[model samples]
Target: MKFTLNTRKVLEFNRILNPLQNCLRMLVSKHELISLFTLFFLVYNLNMRSIISGDTLPTSLLPFCILEHRCVNLDSFGAYIETINNPYMFRQIDGHYLSQYPIVTPLIITPLYLVTYILLKISSCPIDMFNPSFQSIVLLMEKLSASSIASLSCIFVYLSIKNLTNKKIGIISALIYGFGTDTWTISSQALWQHGTVELLLAAMIYITIKNELLENKLNYVFLGFLSGLYILNRPSDSILALPVILYIFLKMNKENIKWFFALVIISGSFLLIYNIYYFGNFLGGYSSLSDGMELNMEVLSRLVGLLFSPSRGLFIYTPVFLFSVFGYLTIKDLPNEKLRFLLYALGLACILEIMVYSIFFWWWGGHCYGPRYLTGILPVLAIYLGLYMNKVSKEPNRYFKFLIFGLIGVFIIWSLFVQFVGAFYYPMGNWDSKPNVDENPQRLWDWNDTQIMRSFHAGPYAYDSRWILLFHHGFGNIYNKITKISNY
Candidate 1:
């Protein structure tokens, strides 16, 4: 077994690579690992950490209240709320200050806040919500937690598409959902309810698809739980519950159907009880939102604005989703009747969601970037895109397929660019505030001064660098202290 030095080195290199090669082989063969890799990839994009919507401020702090004070109300943070003075996001119910938005998202992310709280305590860093130095850390935590949840949606997207079509299409569809939509810019950048809703919807789709192929009682139970949580997360999205219930009713056996409804009732009871106790209504704080909605002649314009307006247009922000229309039109081509029905139901749900939001006074979704109101429907649209991608994968004509694929590639790139601008450069120019899009809804139609163009003009590096510096400054002090203690 005598060998020269070069041969010994060669053997050492191969030995090191053997484990890595096996790991790579396993990751490629297993869809689960590939999906997890997608999660890490989506979460690590530091450029997205620059923006946090004020709507998420209460959610960012609610987790702390839950962990430290054993309460959902933000009573302890009254001084901080006063300092920020963002009244739209909070509600004064009796004597307690609660989040005006859904509470389930904050409740779900509470464990993440707990982990960060423990780490800060271990590092001897002060945990003050009011401290300018610490506020960025809180925002960072919200960004990371939201990003993680949004990334998980991408995982389910991959799994669902893979089950329906193939691995290649699954990967492409997952990337499109994660990077080419508001999932990256809006949902992942803050503790918006949309991220949680998207995750639930994606999981439900996966469970439904998986159960269709291989029957599972637990899947039905999980689907019902998701449906209930979906209702509590965003009341506007509750329209989707109808389609979900119908799908289960049509497909599941009697025993499984009972299990499904039982879980739904159990999970939904929390919201109903909380609403009754706090707001004296079943809808909780969202009752006020319902009051602001009305059907009028303006509904037609709003419906058009939701799809084509410059500021909050769905197509303007994510044009790649236009293919979903094609997917919907060709739904009859799908072999599975159940899958076809689900797609049609989801399509109708999406339309209803748009119609419902169009009547709301705040259809532009406040100060945030892009079509945030449309975010809840993104998973459905993404599924439609996946369907179209699956069809494209099977296209027999080489030139026609190439042309179609090239067009898709261009749209995807443009969509990703738009989302990148939103993630890093939003609110830089104060386009949402100067005229106040809420006060003057007409600004939404101003093609001359668009949100995307304004964000680009403001530039991403300037805004993103400020966040990078804040993170460095906040974490650097903790790192220095830990190093000093270790040396001691």
Candidate 2:
């Protein structure tokens, strides 16, 4: 005899919209879904997919010295860091800047560098193991570097929120910031200064925190040093602190003038030196330099979209963060709260928006969908919005909050999976041979005028009827398979 289902089971069954279940809600039948995963699974089944896939190349080599791996004695930014750790004989003798990469990144990645350096030293391994241009070593270094920055950013986000709210709220904020999809993805890659947004936010928050810096005096002096580095990386970072500067002026009245002057002197010194040293000018590193830039209008347009209305005013970067807009404004329980946060966050957004408009080349989505340069701003934006989402969900049923942010977390995890899988897939020669389909793998590459080949999007190959092409390398028909999956 059939038994009646309980109310609990009924409710559980009704709420069967889990992410795993969602994945199963396919556009095709069960057999077809099996076919699809089977196809994907086969592509990734190869034991050493990453080796065949050239995706890990960037991770293996540093991008300093105008983007070459081992052009010696160029005084490049990366060479600077390597010199510090490895003691390059010629660069030290030459006293050059080409030997160094940006100190900002080296400073951030120091822990990893130091550890890697020590391990190599202790093991008596060659220093090439720590060289950023050494692909295998560099890739490992880059991944560790990315993880460190991500963890650091997560810690800072937690502290920033915790400074403003309760520990519970801080934990919530930290989790969101740490696990948000974009932050996780960007942080997982060996992107440069990708943690700058966190640093920028920290500076903004510190400056905005009433008289914290000015009253403390010494902290303001140090912040000045940071401010210089901050401005050097992205001038727009300075704008993030303006609201706090204005707050000090308004609150401290006449006394704030000294504070402002001191702040300016400190920030100016670094920028002054950066310009003098990098480009042999005190005020014209990027502000006045114009040369062979591949300025693309489309890339610039997308860069402007980070906070513009077309991006739904920042929600596109973090869809789960749509709720954060209100929390960001409302969390400031005092007039100062609203004044400082709205002005600082919004102020930073405004300046970044302007810079995006002004700069044409060196932008993302020009060649890749995930713009590498803008990643510096992405973490903070994601953290700010993610924290806001967590905050709002508190008033609603905690379960609902959990459900919403939980889904957000799930989405973030999915994105993370994509990044993680993508991160390692190419180096592994990923492939699957389960479907029993036989086809030449030559379609994966496109011949160019320069004689050097590159991968083309799958559809173009299919349209051109070159899916099989001539000689294939690793996998058979991966391009067609991926293109077909993407079409759906």
Candidate 3:
């Protein structure tokens, strides 16, 4: 009887152990493991250099909307009057009190803030708006939201590429977006407006490439909703999306057109009402050409800087975009007109975004990493780059193969290093200046300061850089300090 019992126990242990071992093997062989690993990597980077206080600007628009739900931020009246800053970024109306930015971000962020507020209240914790604990909670939620959104964008890029091309190209495209670009730094690291824009834009491109609308009319409705959200988020960049929208409408059947139009109208109506209530104008408080708005004749210089400048260039920070140029060269070989038109619309959108940003005096996009204004179009670039990769696969020249792949590998490494620098070092700009007055007046192209490189030097600043965060002190110290401060 004892021997039979022991034999049964041994068999049961093997049964469990075998499955566990097989599971490990399966993870090693499949892309799911890579996906999880990449998500964790993004989460880790986002949580690394978080700020607990004093960084809120545009995001404040959200929490205020939630807590107050008023059209105007009445409290900002004194500051607006005192500042008399640029109307393009922020405006205080003469009769009504309101800020200039759109309400979509606030709409999304408010629910999260409310949930956090309620949880703290339920726990009987003292809630001081400026307290370290409350601020930490808010920042944590923001980081988590941004990182999760960014990760979803990565997944979308991966799926879009995988479905359109092959698994290999898909994985590479996802990894490139996840790490080899400012999406990791600007989009994932904090609640920058770019994070939300990147997420929504990536979703738009993903749905476009997924070609689900051909199968289901409902997809067009969904696309319409996304279109509305895009317009709400950043009206300037919305023009970039017009080509894509037009293509969708042209392709849609007559029956679904009403649904698409209805959704867009609903979104537009909300925007119109919000503007009227706040600014008493349908367009809200926008700066006219007389108030320093015009085509920056410096477009030629701006164009060069946007593509090549070390500090602000899109191609410098995200060199994988170079592949897109190659992809553009091979655009003629695309399998279908639908795919070809998709590329054209996306390309024009990217060019328009870059051009608009370049024409603005604040083209560098204020104290962030790597052409943040252009971040929304990155998914569009990555998808096209995947097509470029597919073309390369068919090319038979070994030397050509080695040259392209070698350049890509080197560029990827360079891009990752720059982002790593961004992740660790403090952004060095005069963030305190009033919105209208160019705070960091130094030209992006002329500015010689490179914080990423400076972090490597031996000095007091180096001691505070990410090198210390990784090597000497460790990330645990950040958590410990937060806990210690919370206790106080």
| lDDT winner, 1 or 2 | 1
Off by over 4 Å in 2: 1-102, 107-112, 118-135, 203-215, 236-238, 247-271, 282-317, 328-373, 379-387, 390-488
Question: Which ten-residue region of model 1 has the weakest summed lDDT?
Answer: 461-470
What are the clash counts of all predictions, listed in order? 0, 32, 1
The lDDT values for all models are 0.83, 0.43, 0.66
lDDT by residue (277-326, candidate 2, tens digit) is: 65466533344434423446555454444333221123333444544555
- Model 3: which ten-residue window has the lowest total lDDT? 428-437
Task: Return the top candidate by TM-score.
Answer: 1
Model 2 TM-score, 2 decimals? 0.55
Q: After superposition, how far is residue 222 of candidate 1 from its true place, in Å?
A: 0.6
**Between prediction 2 and prediction 3, which has the larger TM-score?**
3
State, as a TM-score between 0 and 1, how close model 3 is to the true structure: 0.78
Task: State the local distance difference test value for candidate 1.
Answer: 0.83
Off by over 4 Å in 3: 1-47, 51-61, 64-99, 111-114, 126-128, 212-214, 283-292, 428-443, 446-448, 455-488
Residue 152 lDDT, candidate 2, scale 0-100? 55
